[model samples]
Target: MTAIATVTHVDLATVQDGGRRGLAGIGVPISGAWHRSRYLVATNLVRGAEDPRQPAVELLAGSMELHFHLPTTVAVVGPAQVTVDGLPFGAGVGLAVTADVRVVVDHRGPGPVYLAIAGWEAPLVLGSAATDTFSGIAGTSLRSGVALTGVAGSGCSAGAFLRQGDDAGGPLRVVPCEDVPLPVGPWRVQSTARSGTRMVGGAASSSGSRPSRPVVVGAIQAAPSGELIILGPDGGLTGGYPIVGVVCSADLPRVSELEPGEEISLQPMDVPAAMQAFAVAERERRVVHPGVLGRDGSRRGSVPDDVAPAK
Candidate 1:
């Protein structure tokens, strides 16, 4: 493997790809990047296209430093102050560097920051490079002196999307799980991890343990302890607690960006609305890299010739 860069410093980061999908039956979580939109934006800024399977550094919090072994281009997306070789550089754009150059990112924020190298490669496990925080599956602990392998960068133009927080600042839309309605109020985020985001002091009430049932990401479970646990990308496959609702895919990004002590509100909607909301949000996300072909070989947000576009 060709050494691309060496880690000099890092705080709570992981190599994540699209993650292991369709393995939940064998007991595996879809432990991939938390904020899909931001992750894609970072990849596009570096690679000129969004490949979910492409590995990127998922910086959760704090700063990181790296020394390049080879000349390459990289992109840092999200809220952060980035500097290369002691010179201040702007985030959300591709930055070219020479071998032995030092790059530093100071990111201590509520949401995650994505760092995508142009040709960075990661070892794949279960058809993915993502680290499962809860299960410790395919995990890589980033530390100093670690040599990362990748090819030379095929640089792209400066392109990225920086979405800091929920600019809408509205209630998170939720779809009731089965017939159980989720209690809605001003909920305060207590704690968060890749496994789940725990919130308390809402209208949510405690419930007795039910039979272990299938659970997916974004599931809102009402625990016996009276805390609401919203499952993250690395959350468990099945849960014993009562599931009151599931956060809509459109709003999952907001859930991923929740910080401790931050107020979160939930608004229940019907299944059709949830689906429509997701479709609409996905349509908007393609603007991050307009005209770039996605995995399916179609232009981002472009309607197929065979099918009618959504009204």
Candidate 2:
């Protein structure tokens, strides 16, 4: 109802909450934040809770600039350079902002970054605000000069600032299939989008033509040409290519951060190990500090390595 900020510039940014669930059977892609862990962190930084219902700004490419019209607080998660009124702040820390302030997020590289504002709101479509770039079903891409309106919350609370891990490197954990062997070779990442990630540098073990079957996020399919594809959040509901393996849920977020030309191997993991890994990740996200902001509107001492010191 009230204008809080306006987008001065953005490249491939979107308003995303939790994806539209339960509608995948109806031929809809569960398009949401590309990295779930990052999204949860961003949510907690601003609102003091990991409520997926609250929308956050997802920056997939390039940089973004926002001009605030009212006083509020914001937090950026993942890798990026965040500047408020020309003063630099690190990612994963809350910045109390005021009217006429300008916040800029510059894409550093590799993974996507998230921006969470206290009481940020967006128009919901079918119970979600996530934009499926492939289907365009729930939302649309953000562009320049778009005014963002939200009911600014009273304040933010002390939340966690997690230092990003080196998940992108190392062998990707997977639940392997005995029937279909995954193509071997430190596969090189070719490109990535919301739909899927294409990779090169693997041998093609021809699966021939088969019936198209249901596919889920993290499914790894192999083509006849030996190239591999990993399904992303907005991947198709069904796939026809032979499924060699499913990336373990714990490692799926790492897959999202894998950059082009990076070579990766697959490490087969059992169901129990995969579940344990996921639980460990969940627990790590719950760690919080007593405070995140100082009285002078500067981030407190508990800053992560990626965020620059406020100056």
Cα TM-score per model: 0.88, 0.91
What overall lDDT goes with each candidate model? 0.78, 0.79
Please estimate how well model 2 matches the true structure, expressed as its whole-model Cα lDDT: 0.79
Candidate 2 structure quality by residue, lDDT tens digits, 57-130: 88877999999988887878878898988988767676778889999999786677888888668888898989
Candidate 1, residues 183-276, lDDT tens digits: the string is 8968999998989999999876555878899998999999888889999999888878889899998888778788899998889988899999
Question: Which candidate gets the maximum lDDT versus the true structure?
Answer: 2
Each candidate's root-mean-square deviation in Å?
6.6, 3.1
Model 2 spans with C-alpha error above 4 angstroms: 158-160, 287-290, 293-311
